[model samples]
Every structure is written in C-alpha cells, then in structure tokens.
Target chain A: MSNSTAFSRARFAALIACFAATSPALAQPSTVGFDQISAGDTAWMLSSTALVLLMTIPGLALFYAGMVRKKNVLGTALQSFAITALITVLWVVVGYSLAFTPGSAFIGSLDRFLLEGMVYLKSSSQLSVSHIAPTIPESVFVMFQLTFAIITPALITGAFAERMRFGSMMVFMALWSLLVYVPVAHWVWEPGGWLAAMGALDFAGGTVVHINAGAAGLVCAWMLGPRSNFGKDAFLPYNLALTLTGASLLWVGWFGFNAGSAVAADGRAGMAMLVTQVAAATAALVWMAVEWLTRSRVTLLGACSGAVAGLVAITPASGFVNVVGALSIGLAAGLFCFWGATGLKRLLRADDSLDVFGIHGIGGLVGAILTGVFADKAIGGVDSHLGVQALGAFATLIYSGVVSFLILLLIRSTMGLRVTPDQERGGVDLALHSEQII
Target chain B: MVHDDKFPIAAQLFIRLKRSPGRVIDVTWMLENELYALEVLKVARGADAESAELAARYETLLRNRKPGATAAPQQPTAFARTSSFMAEPEPVPAEVGRHYVGSLR
Candidate 1:
C-alpha cells in the first residue's frame, strides 16, 4: 500500500475509534436500545426503501423493456421483475449478513443470517438496529439495501438482453449476487472492509452497484456473443414512451437511492437529493447537445439515454459534492458515456446489447473518480483522496468482470447460457414464457 | 396466393392483417411486414438462387437515378442553393445524397 493508503486507513481507524468511544450503543452490532431509535429517521428510511424499490420493478423494468425489440419486450421486463423477487429472497437469507454485518476485513459475519438476531418486540417496543444505521430499525435498513441488491443484477441483464435462457439467467444471477455483489458490497460499505478502511467514498454505490454491474454486464455480452443479425439488421427499440416513463421514475426514485444512503432524515440527505437533481439535469442536456451535434437530429431515445447516463454518473457523488461538482460530474458523464456507448463499444467489439457498460459502467467510473476530486469536506465531513476512489472503482470492475466470466463459463458448461437460435428467432416471450404481445 | 405451407410466417401475418382489414397501417405494421417479407424471400432464395440475383438487381435499380436528371447547373452547397453563402467548406456533412443508398435491411 502507498503512503496515502496508509494515511487513509489511519484516519478511518481514528474515526471509528472516536465513534466507538463516544457512542458505545451505536458501535454494538447485536441489538439497539429502544431509546436510541429515532422515529423520524425510521420513517424517512422506510419511505426511502419503498422509493428505491420503485426504481427497480416498474422503473428499471419499464426502462429496459422499452429498449428491447418487441419480440423480447415481455422477456426483458420479466428479467427485472424476477430479479427483484430473486434478490429480495437472497438478501433476507444470507446476503444481508454477508454484506452489512461486522466480520473480517473482506466479508461480513453470519450474525444476521436468516435474520437470526434481528428482533421486533411489539409488546416491549424493542427492535434490532444495524451498527451501520443505529438510528433506524435494522429491518428498514435491510429492505433499503435489498432494493439496491435487486437493481444491480437487474442492471446486468441489459447487457445480455434478448439472448440468455430464462432458467440459465436466474441461475447465473443467483450465483452472481452471492459471489460478486455480496463481497463488493462488504468491501465498500462495511466499515471493516479493506476499501472502507482505505477511505473509499461511495456515498451511494458507485463502485458497488453501477461499476460492479457494468463490468459483469460487459462480461455477459462477451460470453453470450451478439444477438442474431446484430450488425446486419437494425435492432430498433420497441417503445421510447415507456423508456421515458421509466427514466422519469428512476429520476424521482434516485432521491431515495442517494439521500437514503445517509441513513437519516438530515441536512446531508437534503444536499444529496439536490445534487442528484442538478447532476442528472446537466448530464441530460449535455448528452442531448452532443447527440444533436454528432447525429444531427436529437432523438427521444438519446434524450432518455442521456438523462439515465447523468443519473448513473451522479450516484456516487450525490452526498459528497455540491451543485458545482454535480454539474461537472454530469458534464463529464455525458461526454464520456456517449463515447463509451458508441466509439468505445465498437472498439471493444462486444455486443453489449443495451449499452449497459457504456452508460452504467462508464458513468459509475466517472462519478467515483470525480467524487474524490469534487467531494466537499465541509459537506461530507470527510476528505477523500482521488487515488483511493480510483482504486475502489477499478478494483470492483476487475473483480466483478473476472468472477462474472467464471460464473458464466461454469453455467455454460453445465446447463448452457443462451436460448437456441430457433427459440431466439421465435422470440423468448413466446418460446420461453409461452406468452407474446399482439 | 401465399400458401401457409410454403411461407408460414408470412402466411400467418397475412391472415392476421386480413382478419383486421379496418386496422390502421402504421410504421410498426410496415416494419413487421418488411421483416416477415424478407424472411419469406430468404426461404425462396434458398430454394432457388435466381430469386436472390433478381432481388439484388432490383435493389440496385431502385437506388440508381435517371440518367442526366441533374445535368442542369446547380449551386455547389445547400446554403448556396437555398440562400446566400461565402465560398467555404461546411464543417458538417449533409444529411442526404449518398452514392450508396442502403435500405433498412
């Protein structure tokens, strides 16, 4: 480790020590004293949880589904909806324990496994609270984090959209959530984890959610190969209107995603919400301007895509940066992500079907690095180093990329990864699900 | 008549359209029709190679313009033709007038 890394670790250790000494109740992992709970924090967190979940099912589902070809619309939407259910179950089982609880420097313990220690005693008005969010009930925190878990894998589906077998996708996602997502979440969010110890500032999952999914998505696209007639024929989006609606919902719900990360109903959360809006709007306009300049005519799809790019890029910086930082991050995200989707995409020669890597992966990276540069110490109450931020972002990318590829390879050897060519041509909606839109 | 046995996909599409004769034809209808039409033609070409050759020739002919249609003197640029302009190269490419006109297929 470098000198900066060591300094970061020392600083983080001091902060932890200070917090532990000052508030023993907050540092303890097992149970929260009922008196320590904040009803206002709990209420906001509950609302935030619901809002974040909205970003997945109807939000991401519609967003992805609108972009796929009509034949695969239902199947594509089903991926998001199904992953929502799948990750919810997995998070409750062991994923929450592995990600959020205290353990070794790399992974969390099984103390919360099957929610073993979590308690809700209505008669005594007692409930469990995570060390991570001492003010809010642990149940609320789990649900909020579960929403994040659901969206990450759901985001990956965009890369291999309209190709993978449904059963194989389910299996691949299940393994990926455990092996890739859980570990990365622990590394970045859990205080004892290496990245956190190194003072990586991912206020709202730039490394954990966006970059992680982006890398995995690129791998899935490479492994699955291109959709049939990919370059030969125009694979136009089915409906831009649905896409706009989804993007709109994602915009609104991101308040919960970023602000909710604060784990409190406080000024920091308010700042996060404000910065998120500024970044998203700036990125959207920049993207539209770039598209108008390059492609000549501005399209609704391009506008929607630009807005999403902005949102993805602003995610990690929302809490740490002010409006000025948000604008700069959004601008950078728009320009870089446009190239990623177009020029970089062609250069990589991978058929990332819906530009998942282009937008999410690239946007996540830009946000993560810029967060280091633009993070206001006064606002965030912590100084961030650029090197540490880059380390966390690139580390997650490489780790997720390699692990996702291995998982895909394992699945390929066993049950196979893609639908048969005939089934694909006939449309997975009918072939796999036995349903199709007229 | 397109037979169901010969061109099942096209035949099915035709039946659907026929059943809804009052349906408003739109871009989606054209797009789907074009897709199924190509599928039928692909099968036909597989059975006999001349169909492919004829289709290629027809595509070329459709793209080619009438001889000497642009023989009349014209302005050098769109701005020169539409309004007034200084003699300078425009930074942006024109949206139309490519030598090779490719179809959506």
Candidate 2:
C-alpha cells in the first residue's frame, strides 16, 4: 500500500480499537456487559462496510455506465462517485446522528453532530454502545450504516440518466439524503423509531435503500421527462461485458450486505448468507426462462437484471425467512421484475433511463410485501404480518415520491435541471465533464 | 428565464464548421458571451494539444460576427459522437441534417 493508504489503515485501526473499549456503556443497563465486545463481529462489520462501499464505486458505477449509450457512459458513472463523497460528508456532519440518535419516532437529533462522540470518544479510548447493537462497537455500526446512506440516493441517478444537470443532481441528493433517507432510516433501523417499534422487518434495507431509491427514481424520471429521443430513438447499451462484471461483483459483495446485517458472525449470519445464494440463483433462472419464452432468446442483460432483482427481493427477508422463503421470493422477484422492466416501462412511458422504478422499485415493493408472507417465525424467530409489510412499502413510496418530486422541482427552479439540447447531443461526458472514453 | 423570442440577446450563439467525409475541424462558435462561449469550447476540446490554438481562432472569429444576427441552423459537426461499433449517433429530431449516418449500426 502507498504511504497515505497505510496511514489511513493505521488511523482506522486506532479508531476501531478506541471503539472496542466501551467504558461509557458499563453504566447503561444492558444484557451484554460493557466488559465484553465481540472482535469477531467487529471484524465482519468492518469488512461488510468496505463491501457495501465497493458496491457503489466500481460495482454500481460500472453497472450504470455500461448500460448507457457511449456518450453518457462516464457521466452516469460520475454520479455514483460524486454521491459517495457527498453522502459521506453529510453523514459525518449531521446525518449519522440524526438518523440513529434518539429524538422522536420519525427522526433523531444533532447530538452526535460531526460524529462528536466518535472522534474524541471521551478521552480517545472509550466509545458508547448503541442500544440497537450491544455487542459491536457503535463506531462499527455507524460506519456500516453510513454505507447504506451513500448508495440509496446514488441508485436514483439511473432514472434521469442522460439528462439532468449535475449541479441539480448534487443538490437533489444532498436534500434527499437529509429529508428522505435520514427519516426513513431512523424509522426502520433505530430502535426508538416508529417502524422498528411496530416490528417492521428490513434485514438489509429493502425499504430504506431499494424501495426509497426506486420511488425517488420514479419521481425524478417524471419530473425530468424522457431523454430527448425516448420514443423515436434506439439507444443500445454500450457494453454488456462491464455490466456483467459489475453484476458479478454485486452478487459476491451481497454476502457481506445481507449476512453482515446480522451484526454478528453467528448462526444468523450463516443462514442469511445461504438464503441469499438460494434466492439469487432461483431468480436468475426464472428471469432467463421467462425472457426466453417471451423473446425467443435469453439475453445476458436479462440474467444480470434477474440477479439484481433477487438480491433486492431477498434483502428484507434475508434475516426473517428460511431457505424455502428465499426460493419463493427469488422466483417471484425474477418474474415480477421482468414484468416491471418491460410491461411497467411501457405502461408508465416515463423514461426511467435504467429501469430503476421497474426493477429496484417494483422488486423492493414486492419484497417488502412478501417478507410478511415468507417471514417464518420458526426459522429466524420473527413473525411478520402482510398488512404491516405493505404499510411499510407504501409509506416509503409516498414519502420518497413526494419529497423527491419537491427536491427535483426546487433544483429545476434554481439552476436549470436538464442539460441543453446541444449538450445532450454532444454527450454529457464530453459536454459537462470534458472527458470521453477516447 | 431568458426566453428565446421575448429577450433577444445581443450575441448570436452559432457554430460555424466545415466537415469532410470522415472528419471535422476548425469549428468556431460566434456568441455574445465570450467567456461562456469559450467555456463551452473548452468543454468539447478538453486540454488537447491543439485546444489553445483552436480557441484563439474561435475567439478571433467570434469578434468578427455582429451581435444579434439571426443564426440559421448549421450542419452537424463532423466529430459528432460516434462509437466504433455503433454506426449512428443518438437520435434527435428529424432536423439537424444528418440522419442515420452510420448505416451499418
């Protein structure tokens, strides 16, 4: 590693060590004593955070860039990289504390602004234990959750791919993260929040990440209108190889995503990993078979899209459901998401540039609802109601949709949202960033 | 809100270009706003070796055009976005002259 990289590694090690020693938590009444912190679980969570971050950078970036036309390739990828940095800044400044700290049923406070407790950490050797996660250090949990915060809004970029001013997108993501992602995250993940109190199950962010991004993506698509040549033009993907590579990375990294949500390297994590695999495989086959029947040929794009569908569908059910549940959800996700991308795309007529609504949105909505049905109590010791799951799904759709629409409008009014016809024709990469594949 | 019809800008934003069968060069944009027009030109050229020379020429060209002159639509620039494998550029309106240039793709 380079000197800077080595220094960062050292800095991170020190921080983790500081977090490992939970001196402040001894005073709090808790089952897991402050004397004990699981190094094994901390190690896993740390790795999981890196994996999730990877999902966005090269993984998600390559996936989006490959799907867009050659001119739009770099611009599409740039959004993901830009969001990762933007969200990280927001997360440290106030996002983490507001979403995770105690305040009301809907939102948290600025008590931990700038990650105050984390950086200084009360004499630099001690850290507080979050009520939600008793075994792992709060620092570990915070870093892990921050990764989720980064990717949610980044996923929405797929909607208004070739259009959308970059400045408008940045502003939209910043506001959306604070207004939409933070509140929803608090509701589902934070123990004191409404959704958690109501016993809604989101193993790894079906509602907060996928559903929220998908809904926002739909609204953004509607707000931005279609790409200039939507109905008339044939915009073929620039590269399937890059997309396939990205999808493969997403599949591999997802073990960390689902299993790591367990917050432990225990039996639950093992089962979560197993279910993830089962569901992804089942969904891929189902999507391919359906595509073959429909188009008389099974395209590679269908297979990759299928895998992502399964991942999104199983995300909420990963911890609650059994192997049987995984298979069922995966199969359903393949069939449903296939329809979502094709039938729904035609029905909506909105140029969701990358099927964000059709795949992630539809899949997440279905996944959340199905979690209620497939959430076998005997397997994961959690029972779910179908109504409650539907409530969570619709709640996210309404909240993200309305909020995202307003954010987009605000951005549009302020600094012109879409690029000019000249810029669009020139390609956003060359036009905006002055970069091209050549 | 600078409406095209309501508020006529003193400068005419028009690109003057020459194109051969396979290549295009010496594209000059005449506009009211010098800095902004140069910014757009820089975006397309992007730190190329010839960028400085081409920009200087465009600056000299823009100086010649009188302000508020109506610009007829120009032919598509020769170096329009084209993928090696894909023949046609992205589709737009029926206008802009070139249609389905890349017949193979």
Best by DockQ: 2
Query: Which predicted model would earn the best lDDT?
Result: 1
Worst 10 residues of 2 chain A by lDDT: A22-31
Per-residue C-alpha lDDT of model 2 across residues A1-438, encoded as one tens digit per residue: 596576557545544543343231222212344456788888898999898888888889988888887888999999999999999999989999889877666787777888776532434445566666777887778888888999899889998898888998999999999999999998888765667656778889999989999999999989989887666565667787999988888888888889999999888998889999999999999999997898677878889999999999999999889998999999999999998888887788788888998889998988899999989887678768675688788998999999998888888888878999878876898778765553
**TM-score of model number 2:** 0.77
**Candidate 2 Cα outliers beyond 4 Å, as residue runs:** A1-35, A119-125, B1-105
- Candidate DockQ values, in order, are 0.02, 0.04
TM-score of chain A of each: 0.95, 0.91
TM-score per candidate: 0.79, 0.77
Name the weakest run of 10 consecutive residues (lDDT summed) in model 1 chain A.
A18-27
Residues A1-438 of candidate 1: C-alpha lDDT, one tens digit per residue? 698677867867754653443222224465656888998999999999999999997999999888877779999999999999999899999999999887766677787889898998888878888888989888998999999999999999999999999999999999999999999998899877778877889999989999999999999999999887777555656777998899999999999999999999999999999989888888889888997888676767677778888889889988899999999999999899888888898899888988899999999999999999999999999999897899899999999999999999999999999999878776788678755665
User: What does fnat come to for each candidate?
Assistant: 0.00, 0.00
lDDT of model 2 at position A139: 77
User: Alpha-carbon error at B27 in model 2, in Å?
Assistant: 16
